[model samples]
Target: MVFRHENIRITIIAALYFAVAIAEVMCELYAYKPLIYVFKPLMPAMLMVLYFNTSRKRSALFFIVMTLSLITNVLFIPDSQDLLFYGLVVFLAHRILLLYYIIRLLKINDYIPAIIATIPFLLVYFYLFMITNGIPENSFVVLIFQNILISFICGIAFSHYVMQDSRRNSWLLQCGILFGALHFIVFVEKFYLTGFSPTIFRPMAMGLNAFAFYTFYEFVMATEKSHRDDARSIA
Candidate 1:
């Protein structure tokens, strides 16, 4: 019964994911969002669907949503520059590595694997960003530092949330809340500072945040299960 319920939830979330992608593209058309050329937020959205979508039906919905988002981007922004394609391929490769590591590392606490994992994660983003964006000599080091710091902050937050909690569902929800709040703040900052950054940015940001909030809320509920498990172990 609970499994069925989670399927229903995944379906709803998958629909919401599609909506956010459309909204984000609209924002790009109007407000000229500079930082998100590579669709970074989509990574988190995929992560969300992966979390709740265990059943085939829900998984299909997730696959469709992600595919549609890609198609939407292609339809609207069909520039297809060499560098863009290059960076994109690199990013996809990096994502593959991330997904692999995320799954294999689950249930393991050893720090060695993590240290080994960081090499691909760091080099992939660093070299690709430099190549795609053409890092200026003067600001090269600074750019790398800033990017590294931001990624470190985000990754550490996820690690802390996931590792500190043995309950995977709770960890997932905490991550959702963290992501939701993070994007919300980013959207607001851009909206307030720039005013009318393509009508879509705000909604996309809010939608993503809402998505995060749901997962986080679910995680809260899951704590009860963890408590019960602990009680059983103690007994």
Candidate 2:
């Protein structure tokens, strides 16, 4: 009965996650500004719930990350430059914490692979940099810093996955990082670049963000399971 109850809980959470994700996308597509405000923050809130429900062992670091993410979402809702800069600052701290967490699990003996993995991200950053014009100076600085940080995260995640290709947790972390980087790129193009259509890129960014958070949650669960297996083998 405990097992059954757990399964039921997971099912409900999964259903709600999908529903919230779809509503978020629809709000973007239809230009429902009011509903967008309602659903945007809910995205991270649902992720928090999903993590709480599915994780066998929860870490305070993960909860802190999700809470900051929620705050970032709220900060970005306004169309003011001051709020956007503040949002970027909060997000920078969020990424720094995430970087610390990922570094704790680093097992790479060689840095060559990680350096090579960063090339793609560098190229993307270059493209975005060349195309972006008329953005506020402060926002531009923060955006560049954020992109560089994300590139490092993606490179480290890729190298980690290469080292442990057979591990599901490694793959989950890799996907989550890649999805997050892509979402950030799309967001920049839609909001900062000229001649970009929000109708197309907005929903795309939102969907990618949703998937990234979901995979991050999965990565946490998979990592816990991997640790358990290692402990069992040692015993």
Candidate 3:
């Protein structure tokens, strides 16, 4: 009975998530600027609801990350440069907290593997730096720092997966971080680089972000379950 109830709950949440996501994409494609304000924030808000309903062991850190994400989403809805900067600042905090949360789950036994894993992420960061253009002087420093944080998150996630190939949680974390990095890269390209179509990139970024949040939630749940199992074994 409990399993059936959980399944039903997940199905409802998933339907709501897809509906909101599609609505947001339609708003973006049709240039319904005002409607975007309604659907855009709903994306993360739906995820937060899903987390609260589905998670057996909810981490406060993850809850805070989602709250910050919702705030950033609202901040980015406005066209003002000041709001954008503020959104970036809030998002930086989100990433920092997310990184710390992931680090707590990781057990680093070999520094060499971790160090080697960061090399590819560093290369990607440099490539993005070389390619992206027209970044405002004021926003440039924050953007750079944010990208570095993203790289570290991706690197740590990748290294964790490499070390724990058998764990599903590791895979979820890796995919989530990579999807998030890709979403941000697309965002930078759309806003800063020339000739990118907002029609194509906007929906794409939103979809990637949705996947990232879902996977992160799964990672948290899986890790929490593992922790419980470990405790039981010790007992």
Candidate 4:
């Protein structure tokens, strides 16, 4: 019965995600800003359901991060630069907490690949900053720092997967995080450098970003079950 209940929850979450993804594409193509804003936080709100089902140790942290993320997305709907900054600060806090959770849950024994992976991101940021001289100095600095934080989150995910092979779903979590980070940087650069509004692509990008959390949730559940099974075996 418990297993069936969990499956039902997962199915509902997946259906909501697919709905959000379709809505995102439609909004992007049709330039529906209002509808886009409406769907932006839908996935995070869905993940709030998963928060309750997960182990008690991490559920509160996960819920907090998702709540902050929902607020951050909503904040971006406004045109205020101050609002954008506040959103970024909230997002930064989310990442910091996520990093803390990842560290607590996964052993980090392999640092070389993670360090190597971050170099390319850093170099690319430098190259872009140097070549795009027209971008406002302030925007450039903020974008680069944002890129760094995203990169750190991706790197940590990758390292956690590589060093902890016992976790079955870590690779999925890693790929999801990496995709979200890279795509986010792409959109940010396009927005800041070329004067292109993200309306065309922000939906897909943000949808993908939200989906990563779902994958991470699955990873957490998988790991927890594995741990429990191991404990049963020992007993």
The TM-score leader among the candidates is: 2
Which of 3 and 4 is the better model by lDDT?
A: 3
- Once fitted onto the true fold, the runs of candidate 2 whose alpha carbons sit more than 4 angstroms away are 106-111, 167-170, 173-181, 190-196
lDDT of 3 at 222: 77
For each predicted model, how many residue pairs clash, with residues at least 3 apart or on different chains?
Answer: 2, 0, 0, 0
Question: Per-prediction TM-score, please?
Answer: 0.32, 0.88, 0.87, 0.78
| Alpha carbon deviation, residue 209, candidate 3 (Å) | 0.6
**Pick by lDDT: which candidate is best?**
2
Lowest summed lDDT over 10 consecutive residues: which window, candidate 4?
A: 185-194
- Candidates' C-alpha lDDT: 0.45, 0.75, 0.73, 0.64
Ordering by TM-score: 2, 3, 4, 1
Question: Against the hidden true structure, what lDDT does model 1 obtain?
Answer: 0.45
Error of 2 at 66 (Å): 1.0
Quick one: how many clashes does candidate 3 have?
0
In model 1, what are the clashing residue pairs, if there are any? 31-197, 31-198
- The regions of model 1 sitting more than 4 angstroms off are 1-157, 161-181, 184-193
Cα lDDT tens digits, model 2, 1-235, are 9999998998899789879989998988887889988888898888788888887777888888888888987787666778978988898888888767655544346778777887798778767776767767787777777777787778777766766775654655666475656646555753555365556666777777778877777776777777789889999
Per residue, candidate 3 scores C-alpha lDDT tens digits across 95-117 of 78877787776544556765676
In model 2, what lDDT does residue 132 have?
67
